[model samples]
Target: MYVYDEHDRQIAAERVAQFRDQTERALAGELSEDEFLPLRLQNGLYVQRLAPMLRIAVPYGMLRSEQLRRLARVTRDYDKGYAHFTTRQNVQLNWPALEDVPDILAELAEVEMHANQTSGNCIRNTTTDQFSGVQVDEVADPRPYCEIIRQWSTFHPEFAFLPRKFKVAVNASEKTDRAAIQVHDIGLQMVRNDQGELGFRVHVGGGLGRTPMVGPVIREFLPELDLLTYLEAVLRVYNRYGRRDNKFKARIKILVKALTPEGFAEKVEAEWSHIKDSPTRLTREAIERIQGYFTEPAYDALENATELLASQRFDNRQFDQWLSHNVDSHKKPGYAIVTLTMKKTGTPPGDVSDTQLEQIAELAEQYSFGEVRVTHQQNVVLADVRQDQLFELWQSIEPMGFATANLNTLTDVICCPGGDYCALANAKSIPVAESIQRRFDDKDFLYDLGDIDLNISGCMNACGHHHVGNIGVLGVDKKGAEFYQVSLGGSSHHDATIGKILGPSFAQEDMPDVIAKIIDVYVDNRKEEEPFLETYRRIGIEPFKERVYA
Candidate 1:
């Protein structure tokens, strides 16, 4: 919803021109692979097993219809006919030619989008709740702050390269931790103090990957004005002290672990004392300037669609199922947030064909004010869909393979394009997801099983965010064979928890059966109306482990 200002346009265009020159030099053999590695990475290009992968940033997962259409065109013209949406709310063009990426970036620039800072150890995209401004119980819209941070972090000269990659997420809603702020490098929770003044509750050093850990609260409440200054202090502390001796231990999480949360906070506070009142502190004028860009759209005076939607629900069971799973209550009475499910069986999760992308762009324009939100769960969001038009919207999307009613069900899996495209992957994640989806094809069974978050990562990097899923699956390497490891009871909600592995890894073929047994344990032991996670936590992982390993 934030349109690019003229400044934004000029900066993006200049960066593309610079990159185009760099790309030309690289292709002409003026720069070697090692020389171009960091250069290319800074522009979000990675050389995978098959071809170069170009990650295009979707700032805070927000896109306009024009941007989506431009992306569709890029997928059609430059790389393969499809692209994969990532958990970070970015899209990866897997088969992009090295020479063609500059053109891709130029095209993205035309739409106020780019691939900058998507890789190369700088702060990645600043993500927030997909339903940021629309969620019913939201404390505040976090996107304004997310956008501020995005602009601040885009090419900060001081933080261009750090010990390791950094991530930041903001959550303005206490009801659901949809942004998974607890598991980010810097997690900011918007809160009101006892005096009713708004501020941030800061959490630092949380991350997944080789070392998985939840963030610890560094500051109970930092004044809103001090956000940028306090963050500068945290980054300065980390940059000064974080280990560069070993790449594996270089992340701020490792430093936090070494310092302990109390010590990390103390260091950050010490650093902050020197700069708390610096010019870098956000001013009321600046804050309002950024917030102005996210003002609400001119909503129509429409009646709530309760009666009509209920009637449709009664008439069509399929539509009813989709309505239950994919729809979320909106702050506006007559509107709803609908997640266009991307987790269909057989196809890789988070993937969309060129034609499908074009259609989604059209649908967004027609039904949701020409806007779309890319969800961290690998789905697309039509945040302003009229409740009255749910049936028609579903009909339009269903034919394009976007109307799976398994929003949080087992089949609504979050998965990475693993061995298929990623050279770093130990095993194939798409097939694993497909197998489980196929096994649980029965709709009634999935619905009865209740809300479950199933995430699969190809490796320990946790690209699919497997660590926080209710049922997390990680592909492992076993004696040169691809084996699957299972973790249970993980969650990325208000009570976020890391999953625990269930004994030995199994052959790829046995994963579906293993997941089925885990579900069986839950189904058999759960209390009336208990969600899978609640049931798992109540019985503990022992029962599921015993059953899954049996």
Candidate 2:
């Protein structure tokens, strides 16, 4: 976690004061609703369907235990007693009073957190793998780069208000992409050439909305030093030429489509030529300074607790299942990365109560070096848990409702707070997610089905990232009735692809069965040990479509 210096603290305090004044003016009728729209948005406050929603930025998904406790306090005192963790690794409060937001901002400032650039057509949160530093297979930890971008983009005068909201993601792992970079406005993949020089494989124009697209590779290799300059070039081009006439078509992805990838690259190159050698070019000193914030923690020198873990697993079936699903191998010998599942059977996915937040903070402090990481799948990660303490951690978390053993399974759904919270949503999404989770409650059945990414969004906004789910569900309105649309073969991993629509929409009541039919088709046709995604690709969407629509 990066601790805020005096400069950072000063800026955050100033922003809070500014927003406090703006909010007071708006409440006092000195500013009208139209006048207050952009101001509120800039502070990550949105007027939702029923109430105001405030999104708090969790930069690159990193959090200190103290920060988590502060969030719990905010949620408890200011709004409802819980908050939703978004797919971008940000946190959203669904019931904050408009007047209380400035006070909330002031509280967040004390913890070195804010809601700036979280909304309103500006560069949003920059995200990466939750396991960034702990993953063994990565070329290098991408958090330092993510932090660099976060500092550069926050309140950037040049990109404060783009044509539409822009998102950027970084991925350093070659084998997997926990961060869905391919679907961002700017996606950077860390790579090395034959000379062992670090650079990025850049992708542009990737997004999901009414028009879904997998961002194309715009540059083969952008040198490490030119990271900020190249990003500035891309944003400059978009700011100059991106659509502003129509809100629906204002995303950089739309601009890239109209101009074509080659044309976009040419424009970016021409723009980069003018300022590539400027002071924005990263230096070794600056990069190392940012890297210092994310160096390895004081890890205990201990061998893997292979025998102890084996004995524990042999004794408890529940703990063994949790270990298999929620635990990941860490780069260190004695440590393991544990994902605290937020998708319990009855609870809304990713909705952690204030008590749970406090518990998580305590657990993080006790077992994971007082640090936590939020995953894009709406889960929390204790990235440095010792292997020897796995059983105790599992037992402690189970009572707190964080030990669900359904990491990549069907029950571990990625969902959004749809019509229940958002004015933009066409239908309610939480109930649909809950319905699906309830229908797929059998642990044995889910374990046999294997890794499945099932995402649900209330509308085309794709807040749940429905486009990338192996089996994606979308809420749709047909003649004033709520219906669900299904998509198959979608993935957000290294081989990212937008899901294809299965067929005509089904009544909300039929959603659970429809998903079951899609799974049935996959299970019946899949070869031995094939995951849901590979099976869908091998068998194609036709079989699943026929089963689903039939």
Cα deviation at 503, candidate 1, in Å, is: 0.5
- Report the lDDT tens digits of candidate 1 across residue range 1-550: 6789899899999999998988899889998988888888989999897999999999899999888889899999997799899998999999989888988999989888899999998899999899999998877889989988998888999998899899999999978888899899999999999999999999999888888889989899999999999999999999999988898999999999999999999999999999999988899999999889888887888889889998999999999999999999999989999999998788789999998889989998889988999988989999999988899999888879999999989999999999999989999899999999999999999999988999999999999889999989899998899998888888877688899887888898998889889888988999999998889878888998788767
Task: Return the lDDT, model 2, position 17.
Answer: 97
- With candidate 2 superimposed using the best TM-score fit, by how many Å does residue 337's alpha carbon deviate from the native? 0.3
Over 4 Å off, model 2: none
**In order, what lDDT does every prediction score?**
0.91, 0.94
Candidate 1 regions with alpha-carbon error over 4 angstroms: none
Model 2 gets an lDDT of: 0.94
Scored by lDDT, the top model is 2
Judged by whole-model lDDT over C-alpha atoms, candidate 1 comes out at: 0.91
lDDT of 1 at 198: 90
